[model samples]
Target chain A: MVDREKLYQAILTGDAKSARALTEEALKESVDPKELLDKTLIPAMDEVGRLFETNEYFVPELLISARAMKSALELIKPLLAEKGAEPAGRVAIGTVKGDLHDIGKNLVAAMLEGGGFEVVDLGVDVSPEAFVTAAKDKGASIIALSALLTTTMPAMKKVVAALEEAGIRERVKVMIGGAPITQRYADEIGADGYSDNASGAVALARSLAAKVPAAA
Target chain B: MPVSQPTIPRLEEFLFGHARCPVTCGNHLEIGAGTVIPEVNFTLQAIEICPENWADIREQYSLMIEDLCRRAVELEVPGILFEFETLPPMTVNPAWGLEITEILSETIDRFHQSHGLRAALRLTPNDTRDHRRPPRMRSGPFWEGMVEFLHKAPHAGADLLAIESTGGKEVSDEGLMNADLKKVVFALGVLAPRDMEYLWGEILSACEGTDTVPSGDTACGFANTAMVLADRNMLPKVFAAVIRVASVPRDLVAYRVGARGPSKDCAYEGPYLKALAGVPISMEGRTAACAHLSHVGNIAQAVCDCWSNESVQKVRLLSADAPTVSLEQLAYDCRLMNVAGQSREDARKLRDWLVESDSALDPQAYVLRPDVVLRIASEIAREPTPYLQTRRAARAALREINRAFEEGRLRIPDRERRWLERLAKEAEELPDREEDLIAECLPETSRETFLPEEYGLS
Candidate 1:
């Protein structure tokens, strides 16, 4: 049987190949995919999130660790589906249209995945329709938009309006961030939440994805 | 060391690197802030211009500088900080950067002539990332272009040059503060040492006479700080940007480094200073510069703090890149002492000894105490590190750097020395080479997306 301890170690060290092998081994041994994921995978990712929060880990380490987790997930995903395993939640994220920057969006996607959310990374320069469509198709609980330039920031609001037009505004939470973005901007644009960094993005995803109450 | 006279800089001198006009323009200089040093200054930080908005860009850049200059006199701003942004690739050639600088120079002169307002101008780069180019331009070529740009720039009549990091501000669609080096330079830092050695010399050449670039992954402040402080007129003129003293018995200078403020407004001020213990760092008992005040407030306070006591000694760190620039020859007599390592006292001691030593060098690097560093390395060796990557990369670079020092490849300046020579120097070895070190420590993700060419970040 693939040792749970060994699996955790692989993910923690960001050894994607090892993590995948161990995960498959565990599944082959008839370990409950749900139990293994809940016990090992989620917790390992949670630890990565905590390290990120404390500044113990930065963007590079975070990326590698997330990659490791994602690789292992590739192995476990089908089994989880057959066994009817639900993620912490589902999220769709992308850099808004006319904005080509992707580092921030990529980081948030990694963080979201690490936080146990199934992230639909829409890549950079994504149109509002793309975001809404991803959310609609994936049954996503949240849609995250990012913009760095003040000039490009207006695209975020457009996405929000698009969500309304598509009739998905009620279901999907919209979160925004970037250098020029602020909490005030988030409120002005009517986004559900805002986070300055990736770790905060994960927390926002959880709180946003989990049982969000309707506004008064 | 025989004491040299403190050449107090007039408000005009701080404009050298950041803002400049033809030196011959003299009193005819157009837009500028009023002279108020060791006091206070306000900064209108960001400048974003679209390519189509040609006249609009000039108008906006002027209006902002003029408004700030007006405030400089009214609020008594000690210096002027203009973040000349090169957004949407405003310039097609060297002349474009020069033209923009000339216009800003005229703006400063006009303001000075009309409103009776003038302070040393600090032209810092607030470049937005260029999406048109591939990630990571060649550092050598980018810096070569920058050096040529700066040469054309001196004619613009600027007094201070605050060269920013490699990549300027980037606006992401995702709303995350993701700043990264263009990945191309990553190759230069970790892989190509020869190219870095050439690029390092070029950077030092560019920063020769300028002041106020913060130490970051891209800017190595040791030499630049020394260069500006060594200038008799500039140092004393912008004295407020120097160390502020306190009532504490121990020698305490309230010095602030650059940091993303607590509120994260792309602001800088005493927040970084407030994290330190010295009283002068917390000017007006504040934790950060006013968002409205911008970085100007910090410079004003620090300048005044230093000028508060003229006789106090200072220590300025010289770039050890030059063969003659030895640790023993650096400015040890000055009041500004760079204590880089605080949490790690052992590392601090090692740095101290390197600075203090003058005679025969320790080629083994074992000459200075390296116990604390070795121990830290050992402690983190086997474990999975959640340690900050910048800190991790820095520690790794430092280890290699100390080894370089021990191997007799580098030298530190003496307690009293300054690098004053031709603008360009023969290519030399640099242990803590600015651009290379910055490129090396960048997170892999940042390196992949940001382009050095986009920001003119070399």
Candidate 2:
């Protein structure tokens, strides 16, 4: 029997070494990889997110803890794949065309990954066409766009319009955020959703993923 | 976002152009101070050099710095500021960065010893423009490097350590890229405790941070804030706020915003209008106008202008010399004084004198000093303020009753001194005038919104 509480503690405190050792030991004892993720990693990240909202934990803590969780997840990823474990959702994320701001985008990407989403980060200054192609190819449930500048906001609108021209508007949920983006602006640009912060972005991604029709 | 030279204000905004200068760019050498009149000009910006050229660039940078220092002294201006930031490929390597810092520190000591220039050097933890940093500074390695740089640089000879983040700027229209210490850096909840030769300045250009992207205190992220908070706990405080964003974090060592700035109009105009009824009454902190390419002498003139002003000088003196009043309370008092028909200059002097008088005399008795009487008398007689009608009444009431008293022209009986005190109280306690004027100037009706209710109590 695995000390599940100890595993949870290791993940919560961001103890990557203990987490890795525990996971390897748990695997030898035939513990379920999906169970570890669902019951341990996801729940720990949920607490990290909650702490962040309450101001008890900040970005540095989040980054370090997420890294710790990743250390353990790397060991479990193969087993989960062998067992055909489904990710919570697939998210294709990028900073829109002509906007190179990525701190916010990267934070959301990491948080989404911690939230059990398979993220395909398109990096900075990604074109509208690349986003549409990646969304279809990756079967991403949510297409997350980030822009830090007001000048690049029109690019976010263009990405959404590009998806529509490609005939995939109905299937994909386009979520946009950045310094200049507001929910009203999101609606104006036809994006499915907009989040102000990374934690909120995670919550929005999970909600959107649940609403995404199950893969055919 | 890119910090492009704005569309407005052609570089030829100056009264006279230097035809023989090597550079052709229109220049306004703006510093962190202001220009009082049309004759005042801007200062040269702190220059930087790429890391690969550290060895080679030293001669060029040194000669420019030496010339600038010599000229600054001749102009009687305060020392200049320059920085050595981590550039990609050459300076990012920790050992290399530390070596450059060591060399720079030695050079700084030599300059001070030789030229008596009070030039300050800033150590940036991470350059948001450094593209070569590991993607997202992966696994907080970026922060680790910064921490190492900070620990070693001060020992090497830095005058200041600005926990700077450029956020992101465009090199050209070619691409939009943002890099930050936030990517792979952790704001250590704990700062390295050290000797206090240097001060910390925050340059977090985060006026536009959204909910997801919190630029902890305007442009400064968590690392800078955490360090500031830590310094607050340490003895002989070690931080100053140098913000470049829309908002200013409330701190005692603050260089606050320009009330009207960055508009496409003038090269860079600050809050105080020189023609505000011919009385310069702004309590706004020193600010430089924008002239993207200014000469060294121009910035020195602006600094000189700001330092020459009594209001600016008084604020600097109050912050540095006196410990009785917090700067926030002083600013609050200035707002009240400005409303009460006092020019910003008199207000600062009064506040400084009040604190001095408060500390010197018996706590119970308020004795009128020569400094206090003369200041009040001069302010009452100075001008007819157009801001409010009650301002007129407030000035008139004090002027009528205190005219003889201030100049030592009145002979007061011992018993009648109480009556003179009563009239003085009346001048201060006049109805509806003060509350209305202060409320009008405030951003919010409840002062608690702009600052904490118990702001200076601590």
Candidate 3:
């Protein structure tokens, strides 16, 4: 059997090569990929998220660990698909239209993927129509919007309004974050959630993802 | 033997009896000496603009400018500098930017022509080339519109040029998050300075054509991003503090290339630029609370040549419109600084207060001290290139933070202690030479985020 501790350490240390090797080794040993993902991978990312919140880990550490986890996950994804496994959630993320800031949104996307969410990154300067279309077509459970400037912050509201216009507001949860964004602003825009950091964004997505089925 | 005070290298070379503008402008109010110039940065309130709402946008600018200029008069302010940072739509349409600039500059000129209230507009068009990483510098609609807006705004009566350029943000964003000294050094040190050389060259040529003063650039997209993340608890304040110092050399690139200062107020690195380059720097502090909250509210003004309220929207408050309120607040801050500037000893005392009030409270605030600034800046000036300068700056700042923590002069929280140690170790571990550092970091960075050719890397 593959040494699970080594795999965990590989992900934690952002050793993508080691993470991939350990996963392939485990799969060859007939250790269930689902078991490996649920018990080892998810737990490792949860710890990474914990360290991020406590300040023990920062963006680079979080990013590399997420990268490692994704590397390991890529090997398992085909296997998991063969088994008909569902993701923790599906999220569509983007920087609002006219705001081309991508780092924060990318960080959140990475963290969500690490947390086992299937992320559909809409990329920067995404329009309201694009977001509405993603929700209907991609079957995204959550729409995450980001904006770095107060000037383009209104675009977040426009996205929320677009969702309402598309008649999908009830089906899709909306969350917003960025430098100029506040909990008050999120509330004003009728976004379902707000988080100031990426690790917190993952936790927010998970909770919002849990609520999505009930709302539907 | 006692250590001597570290004097800034270029202190004696500042123009206009101090670090004021190198050339004359329509604003008659001299920056850097004699009196403090109050610069106000304001935005429109919650209103979206389309072709149909263009007239409403024009009226909004009129209301904002009229309120601010009238408030400056009512307050009996010495002079004012207005920063019209265009929104996306305005920058996308060059004519729109020019129209707004005409409205603002003409009104400020009217105030000057009538009330003798000296003022100038600093036109900062947003850099919209972020659709691609390692942004296409001088091509595409985004780049063309930005160049057009910047080139024409000055001709339309803008007296100054400035921008918070985002050239290196792609790498630096990850660098900041990872708290990787080498990545930040690559991003701010290598990529940003290269972009500034090209960007500021264009700005200088435009200014030369229009007789406009080429003001300085800010690290708002880089350092300030670190700060806001720290403030939001997404990153450690200690790391953010070190990042702020690391950015000084990058911010200094404009001056090395031919741009003159009074650097932008929001570039919290303004004091370092003032100290290292001996140029006038615009700084924002408590009055800037109208725009963003920060711990450097007091220390940011220590070496300020001009005082500014960062940027407030032209919304209504109980007393008046927000921009007018910002003008009143800024005018008062300038009045106090100008009054203190009268006596050398009194000015020192005021500077001491500005430094003392916040320095020990947070590491971010600690590095803003003039003595601390000179110490780190001195180390940075010894470097041969921006990359080495950035490395030296980060190392020197990390050393200061480490010493302050060891001496108990700066109180660091328990959670931040480990990060401080980690940052110090990481900065210390970087190779001194730029090429070696670049080679080591290149393999680690993804090509998807940054282009090697853009930064002149293999």
Candidate 4:
């Protein structure tokens, strides 16, 4: 059996090689990949995320741990696929039109992915029509819109309207975020949710995904 | 043993007194705000130095000035041209003009002594015409105060004093008609031939008088009246006043002209560029100028603007590349370009091409910072998939390491601690890559190239 303690240590220390080696060794010993993933990798990452959110860990540490988790995941993915393990959910995201800033959107996207969501990121200056099209095409359960400029805030409302007009507004929850965007503005625009930062976005996405019907 | 002061190399030679163009048109002088110092953004560069914020100013001002002087010297640019202004302290009333002048005189002397740099001081008297809460410049009192201030300027170590014709309800036409340009010029001409000459002669009896540029208004817009003087062979006096203060080499006094607006203004655009081209002077415009010409977006426009200008042979382009470019590469290229000026054109072209080609890989193209990977991971954590599954797994590992460090499970060394300190300082202002920080912490010889996988970015 793989040493779960050592695997956890490797994850915590951001040791990619050790994590991969231990994960592969466990797989060879016929240990369930999902069990190792859920117990060791997920828990390890959850701790990392908590630390990051608390300001205890910074970008470098976060990046290193992410790299280690990636290597370990590569070793276990085929086995998980064979076992028919499902992902958390699907999401569509972009920066609103006329706004070229994307750091906030990118951070949310990274955090969402770290939370185990499949994100279709339509890059900056994406029109409302483009957001709706991407949502429909990807069958995304959530649509996250971002705008950094006060000038570009109107673009977010236009995008939400476009989604409503497409008759897919009810199908996907729209979440708006950015530096200048506030919860009051989000409510005023009739958005399903609003998050201030990347970590909050992940938590919001998880809650939104839980509300979605399994059949849909 | 006394600590030795660092020697500042005279990168650019001052020609003392020479005339490149005997007859020159009026040029636009940006005053009120400071000169756009080298390296920093235009807005920050032009901010007024406030004594109230002196602590912050003291932290960066010396370094900023040193950098600016070094760049000017290295680029072999002519002497610095600056518009000097003093705001009455919040605690003091407007009647303390003498005190304000004394404070300003002390500050200017200290600035010059510390940097071994002198500046042309254009003194604008307070406008008190409006009966508002704070009285502005009253035309008569203003000129009288300036003349008094000029009498004491030489003793305070000021090189030259020019009258600023900026204020009043009449100065709104964007032309010299409303401004006090003619009055200031006449005053200089009248006094310069008599009392001013005696005062200046006494002030600089040890040095040559040929280096001075005669006093004139800090012209707003393309001063059409000043152009008329240039046509009449009277520009030599004004140029002499400038030379007295700055001692600029004749070949290096680049006359820059541009429209005054926060953004692009069509009405001013045509006239401004036309005036610049007519004056046989260099033109300085923002990103809009290049964006309009190149029809490109973002940094590409800025790069093209600075590079396309034949006059900007010694250009310093800011934020030219996305943060995704390796820090090591960026720093290396910056130093390399400074050493060898020939690579500017090629570097700009390469940068433009890189932006175009890397548009797709830009996962968070909406944001300019390079921390998009973090966002992607967070999203994937909540909604998993085959495509994002790998990314989520990678982010998890990164988070784990972060957690360990936070919990004090991992101990960082002293050398690495210093590196982290520097990184923390830099990151407070700007977001940067962790791998880059790690590399920076390492010894110069031991520093390794950052791999995307090493930081879970891949």
Per-residue lDDT tens digits for candidate 4, residues A1-216, read 668989887877779899889988998998888888878887887777777676555443555676687788877777777888865678889988756445457657766765667789887778899988888787888889998655467778888899899988777888999866899999998898898766678789888888776654
For candidate 1 chain B, the 10 contiguous residues with the lowest summed lDDT are: B245-254
Top DockQ model: 3
> Which numbered prediction scores highest in TM-score against the true structure?
3
Model 2 regions more than 4 Å off: B1-458
Off by over 4 Å in 1: A13-18, A54-64, A81-90, A96-104, A123-141, A148-154, A178-185, A210-216, B1-63, B71-83, B86-106, B115-129, B136-458
Candidate 2 per-residue C-alpha lDDT over B1-458 given as tens digits, one digit per residue, 9 for 90 to 100: 11111111221211011111111000122222222211111111222233554565445434433443445444433333334443322224567655655555566556667766454444444543323212222124544465455556555544434333322111101111111111101011001000000112212222112111111111233222322222222100111100110011111011222111111111111111111111111111122112111111122121111221111111124333111122222233323433322344443454344334332321110112223222332332232321222233233433433454455543333433443454345434433443343333233222221221211110
Docking class of 2: incorrect
Docking category for candidate 1? acceptable
Can you write out model 1's per-residue Cα lDDT over B251-294, one digit (the tens) per residue?
A: 10101122111110121222222212111111221212121111
- Which rank order by DockQ, best down to worst? 3, 1, 2, 4
What are the DockQ scores of the candidates, in order?
0.25, 0.02, 0.46, 0.01
Task: Mark the 10 consecutive residues where model 2 chain B has the least summed lDDT.
Answer: B188-197
Between candidates 2 and 3, which one is better according to DockQ? 3
Q: State the fnat of candidate 2 relative to the true structure.
A: 0.00
Question: Candidate 4: global Cα-lDDT?
Answer: 0.41
Task: Between candidates 1 and 2, name the one with more favorable lDDT.
Answer: 1
